[model samples]
Target: MVDGESEAADIVEHYELDYDESGRITRGYQQLELVRTREIVGRHLPPGPLQVLDVGGGTGAHARWLAEAGHQVLLVDLVPRHVQAARALAEEGLSVRAELGDARQLDIADESFDAVLLLGPLYHLTDRGDRVRALREAGRVAKPGCLVFAAAISRFASLFDGLARGFLFDPAFRSIVERDLAEGQHRNPDRHPGWFTTAYLHHPDELMSEAAEARLRTVEIVGVEGLCAWLPQLAEQWEDPERREVILESIRAVESEACLRALSPHLLLIARRPG
Candidate 1:
C-alpha cells in the first residue's frame, strides 16, 4: 500500500491477493471485463502491429484479446494473483505477458510501448497527486502520439454509492466526499478493514485535467456501459448479436453529449502523449 494513497491497505486486502477464484475475472467485474476487452483494445491499436500495456487490467482480458489479434501486449498489475492468472492464460498461445507491479511505476524503460491501457488505477488512487503520478508513469513508458485509455467513475455516482450504501457519513468516507465536491472531481474510495473495496467517483473534467497535468492530450472519451453498470440485467438482456450491438451502440451513443456524458457511471478517455 502506498502511504500517500488512501484505500491502499483496504483494497489490497479485499482483492483476491493470490488470484484464487475471486471472481473479478468471471464474477462481479464481469461487465468491465468484456467492455474493456472489446472497446479498449480497438481504441488504442491500429490495423497493423502495435505494442500495448494493460495497466491493472486484471485477468489479461484486454491483453489476451489484443495478443490473439496479432499485437504485442504486456499485462501489468499490483495483485500477484491477477498477474499469475493472466500469465497462465497467456501460456495457451496468446501474445501476452504479465508482470507484477504498481500502476504508478513501471519496470520498463521510458517510451517502451506504443499504447497504454490504464483501466483500473484511476478509479482507485485516492489522492489527485497519486493519480497524476500513475498517469505520468504511463506517459513515461509510452512513445509520443501513443494512445492511452484510462477509466474513471462519475462524481455523482460516488455520492450515490456512498449514501445508498450507508457509508456517506462515515468519518473516513466523509473526508473524501467533501474533497471531491470541493475540487469538483474525485471523491474518496477509502474502505473499512475488509469486506469491500474503496472506489472513487469522478468527473470527466477532472480526468481531462489530470491528463493535461500529465502532459497527455485527449483524443476520445468513450463511456463503456456507464448507464448500465447499475442495471445488472442489461448486459444479460443482449440475447443476440444484433441486440448486443444495439445495446453497446446505445451506451456509446451518448459518448459526447455533455449532459449525458457527465453523469455516465464510468468513463474511458482515449488520450495521447504529445511528442
Candidate 2:
C-alpha cells in the first residue's frame, strides 16, 4: 500500500468509525443522501447482471442492494471490520464478494468491471495526488465506456454542518470549520469522533478536474442532498411520504445547477472511462 493509503487505513482502524457506517445512512440527512444517491445512480446504470466493483464500499450497504438487484458485486474496503460485515451479508444470501484492499491499488484486473463505484475513498485520501491515483485506478479497472460514480464531501460541508447543528458554538469545531473553508482539509486532532476524521473536501470544479486528470470523461456533477441537508425539521419531514417527495423534488430541480452545487454537503461526479 502507498504511504497515504497506509496512513488513512491506520486512522480508520484507530477511529473505529466504519462499524457504524452501515446504519449511519438510515437516519437524518444521511438517509436523504442515500435515497438520492441510489435514485441518481440507478437512473444511469445499464442493464443488470453486470460485473460491478464497489471500491471502499463500507459495510456493503450499496453492494448488498446491487447484489440483490442481480448484479455480481465485489466490495473492497480498507477496514477489516467493514469487510467482515459485508461478508456476513452473503450468509444472508446476498451475492457479494467482500475483500480487504486499498483503493489506490486494487488487486483486480484491468478493464474488468462494468461499473466502478468510489463512494468513500476520495474524501479520506487527503492528498490531491493520492486522490488522483485512486481515480486513475478506478479508470484502469473500468471497461471502456463504463460509468464511474465518485462521491465527495463538499468544501463547504463543515461550515454548513456547523451552522445547521449549532456546532459553531464550540470553539474547536469552529476552528475545524475555518480550516475546512480555507483549505478543504479536515482534521479532528482532539480525537472527537463526532467531529469526523481526516479528509479533504472538494469544490465542484476541482472534482471534475481530478476526473479529467484520471482520463475519465465527465458526464455530470450533481448535489446529492441539494439545499435540504440542514433542514431543521428533516427528521420529522422524512417521516411523512408527501413531505419527503416534496424534498426530493426540490433537490432534483437544482441538483444540476452549477451555481448551487457547493451548497450541498455531498456531491456525486458521474464520469465515463474513455473507450
Candidate 3:
C-alpha cells in the first residue's frame, strides 16, 4: 500500500467499516441513498461495454451490481478487510477485481476508465487538499467527457440526525452537534466513538467547488434522500411496498429542487472531466 493508503487504512480501521457497510443498502435510511445513487449513476453510464474504477468502493457494495450489469469493474479500497470482502464477491463471479490502494494516488494510467466512482473517500479524507487529491486522481483515470460519481455526507447531517434521535439536547452531544454545524469537520470523542470517526461533511456548494477544482464540469449535485433522510420514522416505510415507493418518489422528485438538497444525509455529485 502507498503512504496515503496506509494512513487511510490505519484511521478507517477504527470504524470496522466492513461490518457497518454490510447489507448497507438493503435496509433503513441507507437504502434511500443506495436507490437514488443507482438511478443517477445508471442514467449517466456510457453505452456498450464499459470499464469502471470504483475507488474507495467499500466491500464491493456498488461494484457487484455494476459488474452484474455487464460492465467491467475494478474496486480499490484502503481497508484490507474491505478488500478481502470485495475479492470474495469477485470470486463469486461478478466480473470484478479488488485490491488495496489509495484514491489520492491511483495505480492506473490517465484516461484509463470510462467512469469512476469515489463513493466513500471524500468524506474520510478530512483535509481539503487530500479530498482534492482524490478527486483529481479520479478525474485523471476517467475517460474524457465520461461520468465520475462522487458521494459525501451532507454538512448538516449530524444536526438532523441528533434532532431525529432526540439527543441534541444533552450537553455533551450538543457540543458534538455544534462542532459539526460550525465547521464541517466531525470527530467522535472517546465516549462516542461509535457515532463516527474523523470525517469532513460537505455542504452542496463545497462539493460543487471541489469538482470544479479537480477540473471536472459539474453535471448535478443531487440530494440522495431529499428532505426526510434523517427522520427516524421513515425506517418503518421500508416494510410496506406502497409506502416505500411513495417515500422513494418523494425524495427523487426533489433531487434537483435546490431548496431541499441540504436536508439529505448524503449528496451524490455527477461530474465529468473535460474532453
- After the best TM-score superposition of candidate 3, give how far the Cα of residue 197 lies from its true spot, in angstroms: 1.3
TM-score of each: 0.81, 0.95, 0.93
- Summarize candidate 2's per-residue lDDT along 206-263 as a digit string, tens digits: 9999999999999999999987988888888988889999999999999999999889
Model 3, backbone clash pairs (residues 3+ apart or across chains), number:
0
Please give the CA lDDT of all the candidate structures.
0.71, 0.89, 0.83
Q: Residues 1-275, candidate 3, lDDT per residue (tens digit)?
A: 12455547646666464236667785665677777888889988878579999998888879888998899999998877778888997678788999888888889999999999999999887778888889999999998888899999999988888887777877777788788888888877553633666678898999999999988999999888877676667878676789889988888788876778889888999998999
Q: Report the C-alpha displacement of residue 131, candidate 1, in angstroms.
A: 0.4
- The residue ranges of model 3 lying beyond 4 angstroms of the native Cα positions read 1-10, 17-19, 191-194
Q: Give me candidate 2's TM-score against the actual structure.
A: 0.95
Highest TM-score model number: 2
> What is the C-alpha local distance difference test score of candidate 1?
0.71
The superposed Cα distance between candidate 1 and the true structure at residue 213, in angstroms, equals: 0.6
Candidates ranked by lDDT, best first?
Answer: 2, 3, 1
lDDT of 1 at 274: 93
CA shift of 238, model 1, Å: 2.4
How much is the lDDT of residue 115 in candidate 3?
93
Give the runs in model 2 whose Cα sits over 4 Å from its true position: 1-6, 14-19
Report the number of clashing residue pairs per model: 3, 0, 0
Pick the winner on lDDT between candidates 1 and 2: 2
